[model samples]
Target: MTSSVRGAQLARLLGQWHALPGRHRRPDYAALAAAVRGLLSDGRLPLGVRLPAERELAEALGISRTTVSAAYRALRETAHLTSRRGAGSWTTLPQGHRVATSGLWAAGDDGDVIDLGVAASPAPDELIGAARAAADDLPRYLGSAGYHPTGLVELREAVADDYTARGVATSAEQILITAGTQQALDLVLRLSVPAGAPVLVESPTYPNALAALSARRARISTHGLDAATGWDGELLLGALRQGRPRVAYVIPEFQNPTGHLMDAALRERLVATAHTAGTELIVDESFVDLSLDGAEMPPPVAVFDRHSRVVSIGGMSKAYWGGLRIGWVRASAPLVQRLAAIRVGVDMASPVLEQLVAVRLLAQAPQIVAARRAQLRGRRDALLGALRDHLPEWTVTVPAGGVMLWAELDGPISSALSRAAEDVGVRLAPGPRFGLDGTLERFLRLPFALDEETLTEAVKRIASVRYDLDRGARPTWRAPAVIA
Candidate 1:
């Protein structure tokens, strides 16, 4: 790629590097430094990968080498890197380069390279003011023990109200707030799923959900979503009905990575199928609000949960901000009570500050929605255009809305593609990250939450890296599991 082309691409990618927690500060220099620190801390950028030369990386990031050098120097002085004359500076692990890894909360991480791992975006600028003002409204809970096991009444009420706003009839008694959606899902699975019981999930579902269920030793089964035709609602419903699964967890709204939204009719029928099969429908609506193209809203799975068989999980992570550490579960009152009992034994409750912030943030829902939609829109267009230009051999389906995107690599270059990305300065979530059986080997998920310029650069780098990977040697890729 030419410098001008790379520079333009880098500009698009780096533009989306908004000021995140401990990442970007006011001055671009400070921001890049903190970003480097974040990469190292996140382990997306490992200590020693022999980063791309200063000029290449600089062009890829659309910045001057001086800034990159200063950032590297700062990290090196902090023992985050080691440099020797004639040899490029190699980032060193914090405690021991051999094994010890820095925690994500640590201050220095930018020294490492390749950070295509995080699937998050910075909070809207409006959140800071909202959060500051919301603190003043928190005095009422200060006198109490601050041990809200189910969550603050206001936040729970807000969540229920939001459900109602989404065309679902919900009440505060039906809701319980935890520390974001992950915990909420964890709580429900912990309380409901039994050992060795059949757990049905969409193939290429969120990986963490599989982990949680697996830790419980559940007999996990999958209903594969066809990329060519999107999802097969009838087949999935048939499987659920025929097998009578114990639990069916799904991301119906803008389903993760694939970004395919299940139609409303499908959701209704699936809910009925679960009810008939005596299965609990665990519906995750985490990405419901990420409509990048102003597309029609996909109805929440909870909307069809009238039979009381559906359990709902919503969070502030994907929809709002990940750092908030707040999410909630809406189910029957009895089920909520059960999870609450299970939760106290796990971790008391989500922090009061976060709950307070969530409540405050809920008040500005319109603003958050608008900002997120706008950012995603720009990111989607940029990524689509870049892929079309540079990686013409690859295949990409522009999703209507979602933080992450599911794309095919023309061929089964999933593993090779990942290695190629690592060769440059990108760490991508492989298609297998979305599934357990490794059927997603031909696919890749990219989060467009980054800026347009950064998205372009990331794609260009991946393309260049792929070309490099294909040249001399052909590595045997993992054989994706054959669909039965």
Candidate 2:
């Protein structure tokens, strides 16, 4: 596209009455910097594409011209973008770098014990074979320069079609590939919530999501999670009804750590509540396809919404393999356009080669699911049984789908236990990380991502540790005396 036409398109995009957002009005320098980095990473803006002039962009985005000028200066300083005579400002690639080599979140050392840290199980031999086959198809991608921003078209259509097959019918136009669900969630948050706005997430949910939200300085209100009763429809429904948060974030299908499914009816109602309140619902189904025991799961929340009120996030990291690092968002065409705009500023696009691999996986879905299903089932049983056998007093909910068991210890020793477990080479996620307060101290998130032997060894290691410190010898509640 020529600069004039591109500029005109940009004008129309900005002309659409500015929803630049209330919280975004003040202009956060760090966020703007991160956004600039994201855009350059993705090729949507491309190297050497002239940025809209400061004054013009300020008017277009309906923000102060000072903010735009400051943001441009910030990007220029970082070398993410530069300005020169006779040319407007332009975005440039980060100098000689690997995109995934660095980021806010990172994996722990491989030597760590029972790294229940990652929610993904190791790839089975079958997937390896499939990936090998996928590699064989790579020569085809060579026809192009491999800079696919919206992901390979085949993968986009296939991802959309998979949901369609599940009765939630989606079209390829609604899809955009990402590095993983993490990136998908990040981008969704970037587009949906302005800095310092409220974004609702479940209590006792994944810590990384909280980290992402925190990094954005978003106001977080967590709905209650009763591990005893599984997921309470009334609690969530009440929270949504009352809080009226800007977004409702949930992992309805076998939620991480919690291993509970939001009631199906509530899924529909939740979507309705979001739309009624003008908030968006981001249903993270990263673990949806990894169900154990053949227990059926309702289609994604996106399936129940006609509009784009609910955006379903998925990735190959959890279900198929973590190394895939490819996830996607399914939304209405308009939202995709908005998300693409945000994405263009964030990372540009997911790796083109990975998208190809994902398309190949989608092609072989039937055989792959059958084999993965059996493996996950075995791991689930083993992990559950080990938890029961060792921590006999602890409660491990019967997870209908997904890896990771949300185990509540009968006693509170997680602080000492986590430290001890690390000594045993087994690094477990302390439950407190999942909640804002120390409420999850009596709980532990054990991912069944490891094989039986590893799970067994981890259980044994924990059982041997003694958390009986003199500070507080026995399990005790911290509540003050109730006035009956």
Candidate 3:
């Protein structure tokens, strides 16, 4: 079945479509087509969905119907749209214009390539033991159908206990196990965010969450973050009051890419501000357990929530291992039930064995986390030292915790540097992938999850790439053969 976006919704997504920075002005229709194409390429607009009628969209955008018609025609010529006599126009990718990987998921690590694209660590030493214990514990559930939509009772209890330990009182009934944090975010988006509604996010936030918001057809409003200061309380609160978005998704605990840990005071004020603004807050705590500096962590954001508006998501992927693929949502029991019900239609339930392994892992979390933090600290320092020695001009604020550091290049050459590094067997996730539109072109997120030698070598390779690019080395690529 095909879904359609209405006129006003499409118009909201096409905000200032005709405004192009750093390029010569084009015709209104060409500008319009380019904007839509960019959205598709950025994964903000899902393919195969019907667009609004030209007349309706023209009226919504307050443009001429002829302009909309010409834009649609241009899109069709570019193979970005398809239409039939009865069916309306739907979005598609032009042949050979398939989007580059966003590096939000796992990619094959076969070869000598040093992949700083993904921010996941290898499985810890404790994981194999945990898996063995889980296997031993799995046979008891074999007699059943093995479907636990809400999650296994023991794992739920463990997750709830963790929240309580973090100062948020929770119960087993309040937890819904997801395959990972991404799925937890997806389920919440489906349940809470309606199409055409406004959702607020940080400017350089997680790319996957932006993808999810766009997939839901929600109007994304962005708030900027500071590298030195992290969040501006007054500015963010003002945005909440002005936009009145339906939801605000924040990664307060060692936020992704930026790695700014929200202080307890800021967390309290943020929660109160969202409560006053009547926006449901989705706080991601995936990196909370990876504190490398032995600092006291702030309480979970849900602890400060007076109203039932805050939803907390955590997972073992960041702190433990990505292979386990266990994540959960902490909310009111009623909301948990609602999310579980919606989740059943998606994947039925998370695997039983993984949940069992997650339970054992949580039981060994103290020891596992201690060892992991020590290992990550050494790697992080090694990368930092390497950057300082080889690429001294780049500005990188040491992250308190998290797998990656966001470094600002001296110039807006991050994209070029990433392309050049590919030739030297170093894969990078460029800075723009973490932000809206084409912003953040001057920054790069470098992950230190690899071993010390690998991280140091990757930095050296990246420095060499930068040096060549600074000296006017241009990269060339051959066209990929299309598979017909």
Off by over 4 Å in 1: 1-114, 473-484
Clashes of each: 16, 12, 0
- Which candidate number maximizes TM-score? 3
Ranking by TM-score: 3, 1, 2
Q: Work out the TM-score per prediction.
A: 0.76, 0.73, 0.81
Compared with the true structure, model 2 gives a TM-score of 0.73
lDDT per residue, candidate 1, 362-424, as tens digits? 888998888888888888888889989998887776678888778888665454466446445
| Local error of candidate 1 at residue 277 (angstroms) | 1.0
Instruction: Decide which is better by TM-score, 1 or 2.
Output: 1
Score candidate 3 by lDDT: 0.84
**In candidate 2, what are the lDDT values of residues 1-484, reduced to their tens digit?**
4242243334442222222122134345533444445333322234556777777766666667787778778787666677887677776644443222111111233444356656776664556666677788889878877766667788889998888988887888889888889999998888888888888888888777887887788889988788866667777777777878888788888887788877768888888877877778988888778766776677678767966688889888766778888899988878887888788788777776677678777787777777777777888898878877876878777787778888887665444456445445566676766766445657888888788888988887877663333232221112222333
After superposing candidate 3, which stretches have Cα over 4 Å from the reference?
1-109, 479-484
Best candidate, lDDT: 3
lDDT of 3 by residue, 261-356 (tens): 888897888889888888999999889999999899988889898889999888999889888889999999999999999999999999999999
Residue 200 displacement in candidate 2 (angstroms):
1.2
